[model samples]
Target: MNAKDPITVLPTDTAVSQRAARELLSSIEQAQRSFGVASVVLTGGTIGIQVLRDVRAFVENGFTEADFSKVEFWFGDERFVARASDERNEKQAREALLDHVGVPEDRIHAMGAAGEFETVEEAAEAYARELTAHAAADSTLPRFDVLLLGMGPDGHIASLFPGTGLIDAQGLTTAVRDSPKPPPERVSLTRSTISSAREVWLVVTGEGKADPVAAAFAGEPADVVPAGAVAGVESTRWFLDEAAHSKAAERGA
Candidate 1:
C-alpha cells in the first residue's frame, strides 16, 4: 500500500495487542506454507513489547509451536549498548518471546552490541554484511515476510528521527549517533532496506502518536515525519488504537 493509503486497522488499546498477536502468528503460518521458512523483522517499544508478550500467551494457550520453529526473527533497530542491557531491543524481545518460543538460535539475527564492535559505525557495517549475506540473489535485503515498526511521538521510526540525515539513509543499515532518545547511539535498517519487505506494519498506540499518525497518512514530507517515508512492497498497514487514530479521524482519513 502507498504511504497515503495504508490499510488502517483500528482496535482498542487492549484489543489491538491481542489482534496483532494473532495476525503475526497467522502471517508466519502463511509464509511458511508458501515458502520453506518465514522471516520477520521485529520492532521495540511499549506496544511492540506488549504484542510480543501477547504472542507468548497465545502460544502458551495451546497454539502449535512447530510453525514458530520455522520462523526467523530480526530487529528493525537496536541500542548500541551491552547485549544484556535493558535498553537493547533484542534483550527485551528475548525476555518476552524468543526465549519462550523455541526459535532456532542461528535464525535469530541481532545487531552488534557494545563490546562486540569498536564503534557504532563498525557495528552498522557488520550488520550490513550479515544482511547482505542473507539477501536474495537479486536483492540487497532478505525477503522479509513481515516487518513490524513503531512510531515515536516525534515521528521517528526505528532509530531514524525526523530531520536527521539518516532519514534518507541508503544502505542495508546505518549507525545512528546523538539520537534524541537516550543512549544517543543506535543501529537501524535504512528506509530503502525496510521498504523491501513484503508487508510492513506500523503498530502504534496512545494519544501522543495521533498527530504524527495523521500527518503520515496525509503524505507529510519525510523530513517532517520520517514515518511517511517507508512503505512495504506489497502492503503497508497501520495497526492503531483509538487514541492513536484520533487525529486521523478528525481529518476524515
Candidate 2:
C-alpha cells in the first residue's frame, strides 16, 4: 500500500549502494529458490552502477553463496549506441559486475547495439521479442525477479521522462527517438513491463533529486513524476540517501 508506505532512507550514497547490494543478493536467492532461475532488470546512472560494484565487493569479500552465473541480467533501458561504447548501460553493467561475476554472455540479454539495427524502433522490437521468448508458458513477458530503476532529478525512470508520451507507452518495450538527455536514441522497457517485476526498487540519491523524490512520495501523478506510477507485483522499494530524502523528510514522509 502507498507504494511501500514509508520509503527507506539511507544516510549516504554509499549507504544506499551498500543496501542495494544486500537487497539484490537476498532477492536473487529468494527468486532462485522459488523459480529455479532469477532475473534482474538493471538501470544505469551513478548510484545504479555503484550498486553493482558494491555487489561485486560483497562477493570478493567472502560472500561464498554469491552465485550469479545462472541469473538473467536484463536492462530496463539502454542507450542505442555501439556495444563497446561507455554510454550503453549493458557495457557499464558488464564492466561493473557481470564480468566479475561470470554471469556469461547468454544470460546477459542486452538490447541491440547502435549498428546492429537500422533504427531505434527495430531495436526496441528486438528486445520485446527476446523478452517474449523468455516468457513463462502462455505469458507474453518474462518474470523479472528483481527490477532496479534509477530516477532522475526530474523523477524520470528508465527512458520514460516526464511530459513524454512514452510515460504511457504500452507493451513491453518502446523506442525513444528524442530524449531530453543526451544520446537521443534509446530502447526502454515500458512501465507495464517494469511493474511486472516481483520486486521493483528505485535506487536514487543526491540533493538534486530531492524535489522529485518528495513529489513522488507525495502521490504526484505520473505525468508529473513518473516514479509515482511504478511499483511491483510483490513489493515496491524506495532507496534514497539523506540528501535525496531531505524534502520528503521535511514533509514528514
Candidate 3:
C-alpha cells in the first residue's frame, strides 16, 4: 500500500491506545479464523507498551475477544541486554500483556538475550534462523498479520535510525551497534523485512513526535527519515494521538 494511505488520530494517548487494542484484536481474530494461526510483530515504546496493556484490559473487561494463543508473537526489535534487564522489550511486553493473556509460551519468538549469545551479531543471526523455522512453506519468513512499530522522535523505526546503513539493511534481521538511543546493542528486523508484513502500523503519540511524523509522511528519503523507508506489502497505516498528528496535519498529510 502507498505511504499516503489512512491516518487515525485520537484525542488522547489513552484513546489512541484503546483504539489500537481493538485494531490488534480484530487483526488477530481475522487471521485465526482464516488459518487457525496468526502472527504479529510487536513493538516497544511508551505508546506501544500502553497499547498492549490496553489490549489485555479490553479482553479481560469483555470489550473484545482475542485468541492470543492462536497468534504468534514476535518482537520488531530488542535491546541486546540481559534477559531480565528493564531495557528488554521482551521483558516489558511479558509483564504488560503476554502474561495477562496467558498466551502459549512456545508462541513467543523473542530475540536472543545478552547472555544467550557471544555477540550481538550471533543473536541477530539466531533470531533470523528462528524466524526461518516458523516460516510458511516456500518462504523464508512467517506471514505477519500485523506489524506494529513505534517511531522515535527522530523518525527512526524498528531500530533503523536515520543517517545509518541499518535504514536500508539487507536480510531478515540484523545487529545494531552504536544506536543513537542506548542500550547501544540491539537486534531488529531489517527495513526490507519490516515492509514485507501484510499490514504495518506506526503507532506514535505526543507533541515530541510531531516533527518527524511530518517529515516521514512528506516522503523524505530513508536516510533522512527511516520511518518513511518502508511500507507493508498490503497496507501501511499511521496511528497517532492529536499532538503527534499536529505537524503532519499541518503538512496536509
Candidate 4:
C-alpha cells in the first residue's frame, strides 16, 4: 500500500470491524507475495481488541492457518508496570489470539513483563536491542507490513502520548515515566521508528475520539495528542467507525 489522503470514514462500527479483518488478511497475502514473511504490530484498546478478535475469527473461518505460521507479531507499545501475564495488551493478545492461534512462540516478540526489567529504561533498551539485532542484514530497520493501533480519547497511541519526551526520540524505543494515564511507567516505539513501518493503521471509534481524529487528519500539527504525528513511510489509514467519523466529514465540508 502507498501513502494517500486520509480515508474519510467508514459507515458504521460493523463496517469498520469487517474492513479491519479484510485488511489484516490482505497484509498477510501481500507479505507472503513480497517478502516471504509477514510481520504485524498489534496494540491494545477497545477497537484494538476488536481487530485482533476479528482476525482470529477470520483465520478460523478459513483465511488459512498456514499463513499465520509465516507471520511474526510485535507490539506497537506496552505498559511498563504490568506483568505480561497481567491483563494488559500483550497478555490480552496472548490469551485472545496468539495462544489460540498457531503463530510460533519465537515469532511472537512481546514486550517484557513489568518486573522483567529493573527499570523502564532497562526495558526500553532491551526492546531496542532486540529490534536492532533482528534488523534485516541489509537494513538497520525492518519495515513492518502492518501496525494496528488505537487512538486515545486524548489522541495517544502506544505510550507515545502528547507532550511526552519520547515523541522526539530518534531511537526505536524509549522509557516513559509519569504518563498521564495510570500505570505511569511504559515503553514505547518512538515516532521516528514507528514512521518506518510500511503501513500504519488506526482503528478508532466512539464520539470521544471524533475531535482528535478530525484534528490529526486536518493537519493540526499538535504533538501532545501523539496521533497527530500520523505519518508512515508507505501508508497511513484511519479506520474509523461512525462515532469517530461523525466530525470528520464536517471538518472537510
Candidate 5:
C-alpha cells in the first residue's frame, strides 16, 4: 500500500482489460460482503473505457445482478464539456458499461458538464458538495472501497498535471484549465481525495505510459509525477500491460 512501491500486476495487452474487469468485480463483491454497499471511483482513458467494456461483458457472461446493484460509481475526473460529448468520461462509461448494467441511476455520480455550471470551478465545487453530502458526518469523503485510475503518459493522475497548482489543491475536488491534453478544462478529484480510498488501482496500458509507470514506482516526487502521490488505505495496485510495465521492470519494481 506504499505510495512509492505499489503491488504491480502485469498482464498481456490483450488480456489486461479482462484481468482488470475480473479484479474489479471481485473487489466489489468483497466490499459488498463486508458493507451493505460499495463505492468505486472510475477513471477515463482508452484503457479505462476498454476495462468498462470488459466488465460489462463479464457481467453478461456470469456475474450476478445483485452484485452490480450494490456498487455505486463515481468519476475521478471529468471533462468540462457537454454530457454527450465524446470527451465526457461518463458518456464513454455509459456506452461501455453503465447503461447496460443494473446499477441504480442515483448511484452513478458524475461531475457537472459545461452547460450545468457557469465555470469549471463551479463544476468542481458542485461535485465536491455532492460528495460531502453522501459522506458520513465525521468524514469529508465517502468510504471508497476501490478507486480505479489511468495515468497520463506524463505521470498525471486524474487531472493533476506536473507543475500545476491543482496538484496541490485542497478539498475533495479542483478545476483544471489549459490541460496539456485536449479539451482545456476539467473537474478532478484532488490528490487528497483520491488517496482516501481503501484501494487504489492504476490500470495502465501502452508503451507510451511506460516511463511514467517507472517514475511512479521509482519514488519520484509528487510535484514531478502526480501518480506517485496516490496510495490507498488498505492496498495500492498497479495493473499494467507488458508494454506499460517495461520501464518499471528495468527499475526492478
Candidate 6:
C-alpha cells in the first residue's frame, strides 16, 4: 500500500484483538505457500505483546501442523544492553509466543542482546552482517513476508524516534546510542531496511496514541514523522483499535 493511503480504523480493541490473530496466521500461511519460506520481523511494545499472545493462542487451540517450520523469525530492533532473556520484547515474545509455538529453533533469528560487543555501533554492524548472511545470494535484502510493528505516541517505530539521527540511517540496522526512550542504547532497522519488506502490519492501540496516529496518517510533509515512512516494498497496513483512532477520524472528516 502507498504511504499516502487512508488509514483503516477499527471499532474496538477487542475487534482488532480477535481479527489480528487470524489475519497474521492467514498472512503467514499465504506467504509460505507463495514462497519457499516466510520470514517475519517483529516489533516491540504492548501491541506487539498482544499479537504474540494471540498467535500463541491460535496454535494452542488447533492447527498444530500450520507449516511454521518454514517460517523464519527476526527482530526489527532491540535494546543493546538488556539481556534477550529480560522481560522486554524478545523475552516477552519467547514467553508468550515463540517458546510455546512449535517454530523450530534454527528458524528464530533474534538480535544479540547480551552485550557481547562493547559498543552499539559494533552490534549494529554485526546485525547487518547477519542479515546479509541470511539473504539470498543475489539479493542483500530478505523478502520479509511480514513485519509486525507498533507505533509510539511520538510516532516512533522500532527504535526510530522523532528527531533522532537514526531516522536517516541507511543500512539494515543502526545502533541507537541515546534513545529518547528508556534504556538509552538500542539497535534499530533504518527506514531503508524496513521498506524492503514485502508487507508491514502496524498494530497500534490506546487513546493516548490517537493524536500522533492522526498526525502520522493525515499530516502533510510526512517526512517529519518516522512512522509515516514505514512503507513496505509491496504492502503496508495500519491496524488500530477505536481508542487509538479518534483523532484520525476527526482529521479525515
Cα TM-score per model: 0.96, 0.97, 0.97, 0.93, 0.95, 0.92
lDDT of 6 by residue, 1-253 (tens): 2545435667876667656777888888887778877789987787787777888888888853457778898899888765754645778788878877768998887776745887888888888988998886588867788898888888888998887656788878888888879888888888888888888888888998887787777653334567877787777888888899888778652
Stretches > 4 Å off in candidate 3:
1-3
**Cα lDDT listed for each candidate:** 0.88, 0.90, 0.90, 0.79, 0.87, 0.79
* Model 4: pairs clashing at backbone N, Cα or C within 3 Å: 162-224, 163-224
Q: Give the TM-score of candidate 1.
A: 0.96
Q: Give per-residue lDDT, candidate 1, residue 119.
A: 99
Error of 6 at 62 (Å): 1.2
Clashing pairs in 6: 1-235
Consecutive 10-residue window with the lowest summed lDDT within model 5: 1-10
Counting clashing residue pairs in each candidate, in order, gives 0, 0, 0, 2, 0, 1
Q: Please list the residue runs of candidate 1 whose C-alpha ends up more than 4 Å from where it truly belongs after superposition.
A: 1-6, 9-11, 64-66
Q: On a 0 to 1 TM-score scale, where does candidate 4 land against the true structure?
A: 0.93
lDDT of 4 by residue, 1-253 (tens): 1225456367787678778877788878888889999988899887787777887888788875347788888888888766744656888888778887788989888787677788988988888888887787676666588888888988888888877655677788988888899778888888887777888888888899988877776766547567868576678887887789778668752
Please give the distance, in angstroms, between residue 205's alpha carbon in candidate 2 and its true position after superposition: 0.4
Question: Candidate 1, residues 27-108: lDDT per residue as tens digits?
Answer: 9888988997999999999899999999999898977443778888888999999988998999999999998978889999
Tell me the spans in candidate 2 whose CA falls farther than 4 Å from its real position.
1-3
What is the RMSD, in Å, between candidate 3 and the native fold over all Cα? 1.1
Estimate the lDDT of model 5: 0.87
List, residue by residue over 1-253, the lDDT tens digit for candidate 3.
2456788999999999989889999988889888899899999999899999999888899876568878899999999999999989999999999998879999999999998899999999999999999988788999998999999989899899988878878899999989999989999999888988999999989999999989988888888888877888888998899999999888777
Model 2 C-alpha lDDT per residue in residues 1-253, reported as the tens digit of each score? 1744447888999999999898889888888888888999999999999999999998888764646887999999999999899899988898898998778789999999989999999999999999999997778988898899999988899999989878799889999999999899999999999999988999999999999988998888897899888889888888889999999889988
CA displacement after TM-score superposition, residue 80 of candidate 1 (Å) = 0.2
Q: At residue 16, give the lDDT of candidate 1.
A: 82
